[model samples]
Target chain A: DVKVTQSSRYLVKRTGEKVFLECVQDMDHENMFWYRQDPGLGLRLIYFSYDVKMKEKGDIPEGYSVSREKKERFSLILESASTNQTSMYLCASSSSGAGWGEQYFGPGTRLTVT
Target chain B: ELKVEQNPLFLSMQEGKNYTIYCNYSTTSDRLYWYRQDPGKSLESLFVLLSNGAVKQEGRLMASLDTKARLSTLHITAAVHDLSATYFCAGLMEYGNKLVFGAGTILRVKS
Candidate 1:
């Protein structure tokens, strides 16, 4: 079975603090994505990387950035955490070659900024 | 821009009852996906509808896609407590691998 692992399941940070959320997939998928889920807003994409050192901004990329240094690892960085940024973050990975376009998600990281 | 919308954002049903969740998309899409997410847990893939008039079923849940209408429906038959969760429908755009998701339908089933 494919597994997507997140560095933290729960995190609390102060306003103006820098935060990092890590995601690693064992499936060697070429595409990795970061999304923030909010009540009523649903899941909004923040950033995605198709390959190492390649990244693209998604629908809701403001206040967020991403890093993909290795094939199996992708990271989401919050330059400066704010109270409004508190939400559940999800990481997903998919292989383009599969042609299925189904994303396997990691257990989400619930972040609370105070 | 691609937009996905789901109707009946909140649903409460009794056991053995039937319900349906609707997903509508704004533009053309290469595929549609259905996912289930339990409270405070990760999403689990349910079905992938790749073409027009596609219908797939698992257990009591059936998903169908109509590309021309840019619509999809997930029908739940005989609801159960274990099936209570948030259901999300996502549309995969033609341009990239990005998926635009709809506001999920929160289903509460009482036995």
Candidate 2:
């Protein structure tokens, strides 16, 4: 099984506080992605990492950043968390092989910015 | 810009009934994907349609893609409560690096 794990299942942070969400994948996939899910908007990509230390912005990457210092780990950073940033965060990893970018997702972290 | 649209963002079905969710894309795409996300849970990859007229099925859910029409459909047969979830369809754009997802269809299967 491709196991993707997140650091926290639920988190609460004060507005303007810095928040970090960690994700780790066991399958040695070369690609990692962070997404935020809202009620009617569905899942929007925040950031994605193709290789270690390589990052790319997705659709909604203004308030968020990401890090990939290691192959198995990826982290999402919120510089100044706001109430609007409170959403379910999902981490996904995919192999660069014939899988053709099939993403396997973690259980997701529900972040509440108060 | 690449845009993906899904019709009937919400669906309610009774057990043993059947329905189909539609996904359409603006730009040309050779690949389409389907995912299922349960309440408060992350998404699970359901099917990957890599070509025109491609169809894949698992359990009671089946997905088909038509590259010519830039459309994909997820058909549910004999719906059950376990099939209730938010279904998302994404299309791989030209560069193939990013995926544009639809608004998603929330399926509620009733007893």
Give the top-scoring candidate (TM-score): 1
Q: Candidate 2: what lDDT?
A: 0.92
What candidate 1 gets wrong by more than 4 Å, as runs, is none
- In model 1 chain A, where is the ten-residue run with the lowest total lDDT? A94-103
Candidates 1 onward: DockQ, in order: 0.83, 0.72
The docking quality of candidate 1, as DockQ, is: 0.83
Could you tell me the TM-score of candidate 1?
0.97
Off by over 4 Å in 2: none
Model 2 — TM-score against the truth?
Answer: 0.96
Model 2 per-residue lDDT tens digits across residues B1-111? 889999889999999999999999999886799999888888888999998899999999999998888889999999999999999999877775567889999999999
Q: What is the interface RMSD of each candidate, in Å?
A: 0.9, 1.2
Q: Is the docking of candidate 2 incorrect, acceptable, medium or high quality?
A: medium
Clashing pairs in 2: none
Error of 1 at A77 (Å): 0.8
